[model samples]
Target: MTARPTKGGALYALPNALWLTFFFLAPLLIIVAYSFMKKGLYGGVENEFSLRAYALLANAGIVKVAFRTLLVALAATALTILIALPVGYNMARSKNQTLKLFLVIVPFWTNFLIRIYAWIAILGNEGTINGFLRSVGLISDPIHLMYNQGAVILVLVYMYLPYAVLPLFSTMDKFDFILLDAARDLGAGKLESIVKVMLPNVRSGLVTAVLFTFIPIFGAYAVPLLVGGKDGYMLGNVIADQVMKVRDWPFASSISMVVTFVSTIGVLLFLARQKRPGVSKEQAAALAAEAAVAAGGGR
Candidate 1:
């Protein structure tokens, strides 16, 4: 017989709920408050409320920054998918799953700032890559590679790759190999089977990878701050500059609100696409039971 949820189980969600309320919900309300406040003459917020800061963001500079941020984020997500999908698929299909997973996590074990700074050493004008290129007589002058759009994009891709890979690997791991074999048995070619059977199996993974890579990249500050030049500056940079440099709290808060709203919409869209119809028998029974509980509670 199925055991009823004990007191522990019933109360288990309370701690998490409290934590979310204290942290996430509370901060969100603060941001909303700040977004509606007036910018002070010296800095910070005034006692009065205004949308002047948000209206300022409607200018071309902010629009350009937002556009560039979206473009770069999309590029990073696409590159991560192209690289991670095959790598994750290989890892999932491998017998040495532990070794492959270890390889993936090894880089993650170290500090993120250290890893990002390592890229600075590699991509800098007088850095190892330029020295190596000079040694190989590839070019006379040291290439101006660091602190460009390319550098920022590269760093963003590297930073978010593992995030993409892990979800893709998890989704691919449960895939039924026999499905592809069955497709082939029905006279499908290798490529055909991969297209028809394999791609569909990993739809959830693709959605997950896109969301993980894109959303974080959009808000990423460290990568751009370290490696992005003027053109490479993104919305995060603007948000940061407004808060710290200009000390325009309301304006910064408004921009942040926009970012949060856009990100939430994107995540919801990604998840909506992943929702599959035709639930399994077990899932259907669970849903039915939950509905029954709700119905009884309504009485």
Candidate 2:
């Protein structure tokens, strides 16, 4: 039998629907419209429709910057994953829940800009490290650490590591440790058990972590601007310059649209991959049961 629709549920969803329409969808539509328009003689977009802005994206310099941005984002995501895996695992398996929560929450208490500025102080030529070294007569001159690609990547990894860890820890928390025992009983080594049993279970978290880390890093402006000099200038930096300095609104809008489109496509591909056949309902149920047993044992 078909169930009747509930007016109450619709009422509950009204506020959220209105919020999205006003805040997200409306602004997004405006950006899309602007992307198609021509740039004014001085600044801002004109009403005249044109594809010139998008055409500009095909320029060799712009293409190179885009590719460089992608490469740096990929590298940062890889490093974040490598560092986050062990941290998340320890957080998930550790008996001291209070410490784990403290570690996660303390970083959030500090302002993000302050954290970035702190890095600048540590990395700058006349900053803490160089000052200490000079005081100790360790070096005649300061090392060139700030305003480089390596510094940009380092800061990015630091910024996004928590994003990766939280998702991974959430998935790992519900994990069935008994599955590892089962795999070992079936003649699998520790590494083989983790690869064959553990990772597959947390695939969703890993994908979420990758998306969270990659998208933000791709669109990052402040980090690159502050730490990234000529060698580290990304597409985001170019877009920011076009809008703020060059006053080329149309080109900036087009670049923004391209980034949004590419990010959407990447997310869609990841979602599609998740739907493919592998993990079965029975396996899932068994894992749940194992987790329940483990929880009871802990209690």
lDDT of each: 0.79, 0.81
On lDDT, the leading prediction is 2
lDDT of 2 by residue, 1-299 (tens): 55579779888889999999999999889888888899998897889989999999999999999998999999999999999888878898899966885776566456677778999999999899999999999998898989888999999987777777776777788898899899999999999999899999888667767777788788888888888887789988998999889999889889999788878987786666556565444443344333223222210
Best by TM-score: 2
RMSD (Å) of each candidate, 1 decimal: 8.0, 6.6
**TM-scores of all predicted structures:** 0.85, 0.86
RMSD of 2: 6.6
Query: Which runs of model 2 end up more than 4 angstroms from their true locations?
Result: 1-4, 8-12, 273-299
Clashes of 2: 0
